[model samples]
Target: MVGTYDLHYYQIDQIKRVRIVRRSDGCYVQFCIQADRNVDIQPAGKTIELDVGLSAFYTDSNGLKVDNPRHLRKSEKALKRLQKRVSRKKKGSNNRKRAVKKLGRKHLKVSRQRKDHAVKQALCVVKSNDFVAFEKLQIRNMVKNRRLAKSISDAGWSQFTQWLEYFGKVYGRIVVSVPPQYTSQNCSECGEVVKKSLSMRTHICKCGCVLDRDHNAAINILDKALKQAGYQLSTVGHTETHNAWEPLRW
Candidate 1:
């Protein structure tokens, strides 16, 4: 079959398998390649941690915050319109099929937007820091809460982490996931566990430490990751010894 193809990236290795799948927008060809992909990245000489949330896509230990794109939320109106159109049409008729297809395409667009955002953010984080740490969240369990499920899913935490690990492997950077417990509750400066509700956005401790909740959490995550890896804060960002890029499996 003759078809036009666009290469998103250069294929550097032998093709292991090929699969074709149909989607609402169009058909796509997927290629599975076997290659040890590695890029030489100079040591960034910095260590950073990330805190993911619904309000913000992520807040880094350096006080940088990336706004959440909220792809699904942004497209909800269009999706609802399309869904209504689909329902109004006669069932199993050509018009109904057309309406359903349009709805499917809109959903596909939102999904793609979410994925693109995640990939760019993850890659940027991995490339800018020599050592990267993020909280290991149980997304499956978190989504069980009906109130926050939509927001949590929209945040795409799982996708972001997957790409973070993938880029870390490809770029020879260190990526570690630390436990989520007390990351937000503990004060970064004093290590005091001050209890606070989810609505409380500021972290305050008697040790004279005050910080944004997410910012404090990011710092704690970095500390936990460093301790888990048996490395001191001063030792990070030095030299890449013994292939530290391999992710520490917890």
Candidate 2:
């Protein structure tokens, strides 16, 4: 309480809890604010589905690609160098402590970057589209693949999805998570289930439809989400929104 404080406008009654902590770099405080959750925000009149992947952060239904900023991979060399230096230093030495702090700071920077990226991207997506659909990915199980564990973790899908849900709540947008079952295998054009391997980057169907694999998947995801949400869509080319949501039994 001795130093000047930068604070947001908050009512005394609205403040639920506050906690302060000291860090290697600085001291910070966290506040849990109480407020009404009933918020009404108008839809943006547009809908989009997102396909998240290691190759890119996301590919939207419109074929827009958001590049994945591999914060850890980008700074891996520097982090490794600092970690190696730290390991070589004598244990319990001041130099070793400093080196360790440096490494920790580097990691903190990456964490901040990933969170920042997720927040901004999620906000933009929520604000731009009224209805947003994404695959219901099981990150815990997905990370079990040792071959893709690093890339998947680095992509920060969980963080991104959390931000998406948060923003969706704030903006009153419809954010739905559709099952990831065959969204990629089924053709977005003719509804044909063309089997393909993970290595195939392009989706080709016998119905003369050839599209980017992610883009095709995004379309399918959107369709499924709309159906699950009670909207009957014609196709990817011509999408129509319905007011009623009736569960269709296949």
Per-residue accuracy of model 1 over 1-250 as CA lDDT, tens digit each: 4345433444755677889999998888887767688998787766678999767999988788999988899899999999999989998899999999999999988988999999999999889888888999999999999988999899888999999999999998889999899999988887888998888988889989988999989988987887888865455442343245335422
Q: How close to the true structure is residue 133 of candidate 1, measured as C-alpha lDDT? A: 88
Candidate 1 regions exceeding 4 Å error are 1-13, 232-250
Cα lDDT tens digits for candidate 2, 18-83: 889766677878777786564565545577899997678999988989998899899999999999
Clashes of 1: 0
Error of 1 at 150 (Å): 1.2
TM-score, prediction 1: 0.88
RMSD (Å) of each candidate, 1 decimal: 4.2, 3.8
Note the Cα lDDT for every prediction shown. Answer: 0.84, 0.82
